[model samples]
Target: MKLTLTIWRQKGPDSKGKFVSYPMDNVNPEMSMLECLDVLNESLAERGEEPVAFEHDCREGICGSCGFMISGVAHGPQPATTVCQLTMRHFKDGEELVLEPWRSRAFPFVKDLVVDRRAFDRIIESGGYISVSTGNAPDGNAIPVGKEESDRAMDAAACIGCGACVAACPNGSAALFTGAKIAHLGILPQGQPERDRRAVRMVAQMHEEGFGSCTNIGECTGVCPKEIPLEVIARMNRDYLGGAWRERKNVVTTIAPVSDWDFAKK
Candidate 1:
């Protein structure tokens, strides 16, 4: 199918950006979105034109590297499908698709369709791991973990850190991402030692990264390619509250909520 792609192009972080349109003919309906991009790049290269820069790794959607705004929606219109897994068949012939980078203060644009997601790594570094004796991998059934708890942990652990949560959120909040990381470890026995501390440290680092607070708009979960539930944010808030209650002296908390029509609402 033939399609028109309007892609955002920027030279560097400080450079200005604009949408450049290209008529994409000869696109196979079976080709994944990233594959379509590859075709475009090949055409550009043949013509000695600078190709668009986008992120992709393990194009199977396992890696969260491939993500950007597609037609004003994260990962396109499909639910729980990353851009790499999206196929050209989802679009109709002559359709115009707009692609842009994930917009957030924490995710500054590096180039065309690429944004620096290092802030997520910093949050994980703050406290997304557990302390354990270093050695060979332990047996799976060594610890008697309940099936329910394991399921919850697995659910939270599915987060790919794609930053779609931040991009979809009207407030540009990273609460969903941070919450997923916290819940992934907090629900497990091995993560007990740093459970409360993990919540505190990670939340602190998230704030430091300049990400906005969660407004409970639910847009984060709406765009999450992993389909991470909104309950993860609630879980994170609960953990943060518990941590603050326990370490009242150290948990410097300041919460200022935003409402679109609070003061003027009838």
Candidate 2:
């Protein structure tokens, strides 16, 4: 098959970038999206041109190191599929595909299709952990967990931290990602000790990361390769509110600014 690609190309973080067009031919339908890019790079290398830079670790979908916007949709219009798992057959011959990196303030452009997702790393560092002592593994049934609770926690734990949720959102929100992190641990018995503080520190770090607030548009979950649900966002909000109430004498945070009239009256 033959296709045209208009891909965003940035040499570096401070470099000016633009869409560079390339006509691709003989593209095998079975070739994964990243494999297609690899073919393009091979052609560029033969011509003594700089190859387009993109990120991918395991060609499999587990690493979450590979993702990008394909033709205005995150992961190329496939539901619950990662780019590494997307194949050329999904698109028609002669189709013009536009490729770009994930766009978010927290995720600054690195190169061609790579964005700095390290902001996610910082969020995890803030509190996405439970204290564990060094010892032999505990007995399997030491702590009995209900099937429903275990299933929900496992569902939340499926988040791979791919930035598709941030890219698909109009608000560029990380609430879905952050919430998944919170819920996965919060629902488990081992994660109970740090639950309250984890919510506070993680939420605070999320704000500090410059990610936009979630308005519940549901786009994040729509493009998620793992099919992580929107329910995790609600769980995160509930935990955050509970933590805030306990820490601040029942005060809740708001997007609205302080009213000057009320201040003057006081």
Candidate 3:
């Protein structure tokens, strides 16, 4: 199969980007998208031309390192599939695929099909883990978590932080990603001690990172490679509200004093 790839190209974060098209004459239907790119890169190297830049590691789709808009769809048109796992057979001969990087303020452009996702790392650092240290690894049956709770936690834990949720959202919201991180830990018994504080801090950090608010449009989950559920966002909101209310007194004390109290009498 033959295909044309119109890819976004930029030398650096501040450089001007443009679409550059490359026609492939020998595309194998069995080849994954990344593998096809590798073939293209080999050809480009042979001709002494610069190859297209994209992220990929462990092309099996577990790394979350490979992603970009393919023909305007995050991770191509396949549902719950990453770009590296998308086979060329999905497209027809003479088809043109347009590729672009994630376009969110929180995810600054790095180069062609690459963006800095460190903002996600910052949100995780805020309170995504249990700081308490257990002396040794416990037995599997020690915690005795309910089957339902464990299932939901595992569902939320599948989020790979690939930034596809933000890319697909019109509002550029990171709610889905943040919610998944919060829910996975919040549902677990090990996370019980810092549950309230974790929600408050992670949500606060998300806002500070310049991500948009969740309007419940549901775009985030629709394009998620892992199909992370929309309920995670609701869970995040519930926890944040509960935590904020509990921390209200401490929150108020941190605010600066009001100097014009007498004006109310007028």
| Alpha-carbon runs more than 4 Å astray in model 2 | 248-266
For residues 1-266, write the lDDT of model 2, one tens digit per residue.
99898999988776789999999988999999999999999999999999999999987898999999999899888898899999999999999999999998788777899987888988888889999888999889998999999999999999999899999999999999999999999999999888887888889888877899999989999999999999999999999998876764433232321222222223
For candidate 2, the lDDT comes to: 0.88
TM-score of each: 0.92, 0.92, 0.92
Sorted by lDDT, highest first, which candidate order results?
1, 2, 3
lDDT of 1 at 240: 90
Candidate 1 per-residue lDDT, tens place, 1-266, comes to 88999999988776779999999879999999999999999999999998999999999988899999999999999899999999989899999999999998777668899888888988898889999898999997888889999999999999999999999998889999999999999999999888888898889889977899899989999989999998999999999999967875685433332222223222
What lDDT, from 0 to 1, does candidate 1 have?
Answer: 0.89
Instruction: Report the Cα lDDT for candidate 3.
Output: 0.87
Stretch of 10 with least lDDT, candidate 3? 252-261
Better of 2 and 3 by lDDT: 2
Tell me how far the alpha carbon of residue 89 in candidate 3 is from the true structure, in angstroms, after superposition: 0.4
CA lDDT, candidate 3, residue 29: 96
